[model samples]
Target chain A: TKISQPWKTTITTDESVTPWEDATQYNNFYEFGFGKSDPAKYADRLKTEPWSIEISGEVSKPGTLHLEDLVAPNQLEERIYRFRCVEAWSMVVPWLGFSLADLLKRFEPTADARFVQFETLFDPKQFPAQKSSSFPWPYMEGLRIDEAMNPLAFMAVGMYGKVLPNQNGAPIRLVVPWKYGFKSIKSIVKIRLVKEMPKTTWNMLQASEYGFYANVNPEVDHPRWSQKTERRLPSSLFTPNRIPTLKFNGYEEQVAYLYKDMDLRKFY
Target chain B: MLKSRWVKALLHIALLLPLLEECWQIWLLVNGMPNRLGPDPGKVILEDLATVAIWLLLLGLAITPAKQIFRINDLMRFRRMVGLYAFTYALLHLLSYLAFILGWDFSALWEDIIKRPYIIVGTLSLVILAALAATSYKAAMRFLGKRWKKLHQLVYPAVLLAILHEWWQAKEAFNEPLLHLVIASALLGYRLVLFFNKAFSGIKNQQSLRQTARKNS
Candidate 1:
């Protein structure tokens, strides 16, 4: 079924959109596998239907909410956001979703809810990579309450003016535009309102490299590779589309206030 | 024994195919046409070159062990050709990074080799390959004499460094890198076993010669 009213909004990049093929095909969904194309190839295994997300912890309303009913209250808006991967590749994608703040407010979180932790579907049968004990299963990510409530922080249900493909986090996913793409956890199955900071997947894997606040900062390089520049997707061999990466992925003016007092480098 | 010359010719044609395919992809990119290389052809090409370089390096390492096991002396001649091709691919891989990835930005290239452990490891492996390729000719072998053999032994470390480079680059995904490491271990392990066998049971050359001299007497 098609998404309801994915009308275009001003919250979009002026840059050219990454081709749907590239955006969908070239993915790092480790649940399916590690290869760039693995997710696209093996995503059929995921069962997005009969899907429900458990909203629990410090929220006033705690229950397993079916995906349809959860998405029913709000109007879906089209947002073309710039997605910058931690590996120094980037894409401009037109995502369809309602504001995350809109979704979180419905849950009626208590004052105790300082952090919001999200989890992906943990079914090893669907996610074959979960069979490997290399990474702690059930990919988890968290954002501070303020960060979660930020207007720019979106919960994408679809992209490219249609329902999100199973490989591209079908049904639901978070889209924190300012952070590196990994923080925008895919195929979310749980949203827990907790008091303490949550242990994130990549950060848990390598604390020295991926931090909790993976804000796209050009100055702050990943220990392994430079973040100063990114190869924009749909780029060919001779005509390179490598461009200088912008701070906060060019959304610095909008979201920089969220980390006003905190040093991004230290947090990153 | 299979003719090493014929094998070398076939190997050249086989290796040339991938490079030719890349060239076709490059042509497609230049002409602004759709290509199979994917969105970032430059990155894809860079990876392809690196993959070929490492595979060739591993194949070069496997030659001696394979020859020993199969008792095919003809296999020895192909090692130099394999080593040279491996160096060529490695050189092209680094060049691709400089040209496509960096856009000829020497500063970033310098910084990457100096600071980034993966790139540094990769560069070190390539440098060792370069040294081996430079000294592979007969004149260099004659000039260096016994030292040449000692220097060529650097192939073990060179291959290990390349594997380490691959491991460093492929951070979380250890499957492919681990497989490469296991293969390297097996190839290098065979040589170690032979060395230790000769050490413990006495050198085969002297022992065989003594038996032959006694038989003659």
Candidate 2:
């Protein structure tokens, strides 16, 4: 496999990258089960070898792209990003993937394509949690057309310089750096360019709590808990490495222009 | 069970097991051993300790009903110990949350209690548990007399509030919280049934006594 140049200059974070074991084991992937450790325990049943993404809706080139062909043309890069969860925890991760803009551009999106929607693979036989109706299965996430085109918007295939583990959305996944981690839908099976804002899973579940944009804004707190501060993971027992959450998750310089004139609090 | 000192000692150890387990995990974490406390060890420990407190509260609530239904007089001896342990764990749970989650920031903690309904509910439940614990001693029990029992009835509401706190805090999966709700409901339901049964039986006895007096007249 040909690897792209590392993104040392293009992207970086002052925070230390979370340990591989901690990042992989402690996750909130509801596809496996509700427990944080459930994904790592049960995700092995997922079949990633024969993976393909169906590119459809408002796109000139609408067809299924196999995993191999999807990555063959693009140069992979390690983008170290701070992943902030809506639950007020965070991890600095070194993700290996290409720019989402680079991938979406290949499909030739139409002028009517105002939004980009991504879908995760749904297999009850593989994902046991799919049996439960906690969420409308086949997790979906969306981004505005311009947001999708942002340089920070990534489509990750691997991390730690190795192919993604099954639990961490193997084969391929989306990584929107400025948004909450859940917006980066995992194990993507479909990409749709649509005219209207797509209904994302979390937003559909609770619109008041989870907005369509799902941007990392500390001021817009979740209905259940405060988002002003986040406990960075791998913290010590007594004192958690708590830090004040930044607006746009510290990516305001690049992504703020995209949301100009729009009320983030209202949209969020 | 209280008849034997050995049984009493064993019961105390059994009640302390949850706290002991938490200490063991902390030891393992400090010693750099592979422990069950995951990435956010503080959050994990705080949640586990809170759960332990709730479980003990539920067990303590079950003792009176179990004695009534099964004629297990022995169960009474363990009720006080279980109640005290629940209070101890609840206090520890609060401390853990303060130390780990809030980082001992009193201002933030106050804000959480005021702003967040779940935290408010949890705090109220802890307050009720504290009252019950303070009165659990023999001197307070004697001073309060019948009032002690009445004050301790607050446990029913406290447990319900604690369950609500658990339910409200849940983000996605509600199975565990729902299960806790079901258990708490069943315990309270049993008490209600006993109360109604005694009232109905008392009325029936009064009616029979009136009939006997009329026949004698």
Off by over 4 Å in 1: B28-34, B197-217
How do the residues A153-222 of candidate 2 rate in per-residue lDDT, one tens digit apiece?
9998888777888888887999887899899999999999999999899998888889998899988888
Q: Per-residue lDDT of B157-178 in model 1, one digit per residue for the tens?
A: 9889988888887658688779
Best by DockQ: 2
* lDDT score, candidate 2, position A265: 85
What fraction of the correct interface contacts does each predicted structure contain? Answer: 0.61, 0.70
Q: TM-score for the first chain of model 2? A: 0.96
Clashing pairs in 1: none
Model 2: what is its DockQ?
Answer: 0.71
lDDT of 2 at B41: 93
Clashing pairs in 2: none
B53, model 1: CA deviation in Å? 1.4
TM-scores, one per candidate: 0.92, 0.94
The Cα RMSD of model 2 versus the native structure comes to 2.2
